[model samples]
Target: MIDPILPFSSYSEEINSMLPETIQKELVFLIDSDFMDWKKIESILKKFPSISHSIVRRRLDVDFGRLSRRLTGKSIGVALSGGGAKGFAHLGLLKCFEENEIPVDMISGTSAGAIMGGLFAMGLDSSDILPLIRNFWLDRNLLGDFTFPFVSLVRGKRYSQAIHEFFKDRSIETLPIPFYAIACNLTKAERKVFDRGLLWKAVRSSTSIPGIFPPFAERGELFVDGGLLDNLPGSILKERGAGILISVDLGGGGQIDKDEMYHNLLGPHYLGEAPSFFNLLFHHLKRKL
Candidate 1:
């Protein structure tokens, strides 16, 4: 069981004694950050302390091992970019990482990238996600639904339900791995990072497109796709002390399709003084086309 609001001091004595000072400090920091799972923290402590305690007897140098890597801040962070359907490539990327034995220590994502990243963070492998995509995400009836088109083309109820079904209302902080989902607050006119909340809601909020899907209302603020603000969210990982950063920008400049042009001006929110750089570029290319 995970402690939602407990600080490091409230943990059991066994766990507290098993952890190193660095890890104890990190646990406090993570609790303050509001985005960590105690199980993952405990696992790290359990795995590393044994090695640290027996390194001398095992003829392994403490200066050049897992403990050294942890102390030196050599954690690997991968930032997944929003690209709609193109974001599915993130699963392949993760599979490749697993194949090459590259473990991801942290993750940040926007829009569709959040969906893939969230699943990975929840301990689902790429192979597991493939069937999910085929059975749920690729369902034409769910995604291709049309409504009266008030705020968006689709009502977004089904999409939201789909996300909830996939994640099963799991809390973001309870995941086995660290993850962040980026969203754009329409009411605040700023970017939002979801470190703690229902995992499905964060994924849904991040994937909400202004014209395609209705915005998610939370705390009196409307939130849409993070792609509208910070599409590639590697900066968050860097802020958290990740030494190596791998950012995948799948939503970069490309040929504007007919579907993309049709949904460009469905609302005033899509056209403002400070529009997204990619959105602005998409509009410019639409006129030329």
Candidate 2:
């Protein structure tokens, strides 16, 4: 029986292998956007500006037989947390899940977590996505340092554009698994689960870190990274009736204090002047931070 959650009729080779084929590249079914010549939801909305929400829902509804079968009596949910570069570590954790044959019936994530989680839900295995991450992140042309001073320097255009390109051909409904990308509406001071709209847009919004990246705009509304409010959305998954909720938190501070620190550089209300040389050195380090 064919799993119908995804349009497998449209699947092509997602991973290719030459030797040690079984362990290296397995046949993974995924929907091909180019094969379908899919148009972005944004483009479709523009073409039919007056289209009703119900119509949009109808158009976005995908056949979910496969996913339904997997979730027959289970309510498994996986929630990925926000942790900039630490997401790679989270990816490793996901790889562990795969090795253990754990089923992620539904998924939600924020920031880098959202990006990786989205890819996994779209039928890309960790092996398939590892190369994409390496190529994109290691490309000097894409991540090179910027020129000009007096600004944040990382204006985030390159990364933001990359995000758009990745999802230019897909929508949320096409995900191979149940998916949700979490973002925040600054104006509303709340977390938003983007279960609709363009997949790339949701990913973009989920990664729009406050100072590091610009906000995402949709129909003139502004959205920033969901990490700003709810990074590990276990509550959201629980609210959705998740039977087994697995949350991967990157520990907001990303550090566990060892109870071994006993020094305050500039003591609690210090008014003393340090040596000129030491002050200059500390100031230099401060600027770097």
Candidate 3:
């Protein structure tokens, strides 16, 4: 499974408990992000000595050849990607896996993690799109590059506006940013404030980007919608009948407004904050399998 191991989320124990003993014997690589304390992960690995580890980070500079060798004889490769630079890096790894003929079952936590697990992976800049869409005009080596006229028209608009226009009839709304800050501050007093809906109002008022906006706002929304329903990219993982499981952190206000896209990245604060969603996904997998 392509499990983006966030700094806070740990699924190793759950995975170990769920898999049958016989199937566990064949599991090969337990690839995770270096952000995870190696000591903690190593301790967990000790329980299942048969599973090997591959820690990925920016400094390591992993390539497809290295990955191919790692998975040559393996039945399953549990890959992880999370955090800032790590999100883009994780997409690079996923691209590598697609190239190497490895079947992937992906799990993502926050926005960065979730988007990479999506069908049309989102990127930080145009440069990130090159690897996925090699034949697009953007990828063709252009002489005297001229900025697209559309870029100038949408410069000052909010992310939700850009996405709404792209989707035509689809409606989208931006998530309130104040809600995120309140969620981050985990205190009984803070919780009470949010419960009163003050946090949502604050986020709606305070968060504003002058010239910047989210890339692939519509694509991200589509993924969150379709990925949850297992509609888009239905052909990619056809053998499973259903696609991958998605669990969004409710602490991040998992309040997806229809036809609206939040400007900032969405995610959970710390781990275990969205246990209900996790439990729901677990039960769904149990029934599907």
Give the candidate number with the greatest TM-score. 1
Candidate order by decreasing lDDT: 1, 2, 3
What lDDT does the true structure give each of the candidates? 0.69, 0.61, 0.29
Give the TM-scores of the predictions, in the order they appear.
0.70, 0.64, 0.24
Q: Where does candidate 1 stray beyond 4 Å?
A: 1-24, 28-71, 253-289
Candidate 3 local lDDT, 1-289, one digit each (tens): 3233444235556666867877623222333333333344444445656653433233323323333444453223222222322345545665665578544422222333333433221112234544443432233432223334342223323434322232233101111000111111111111111111222222211121111211122212211122122212222222222133223232223332111232122223357655333234323533553
Which residue ranges in model 3 land beyond 4 Å of their true spot? 1-81, 120-157, 162-289
True-structure RMSD for candidate 1: 9.1
Candidate 2 weakest lDDT stretch, 10 residues: 254-263
lDDT of 1 by residue, 210-281 (tens): 767888998899888887667889999898667889998774532122224213432235435465434553
Worst 10 residues of 1 by lDDT: 51-60
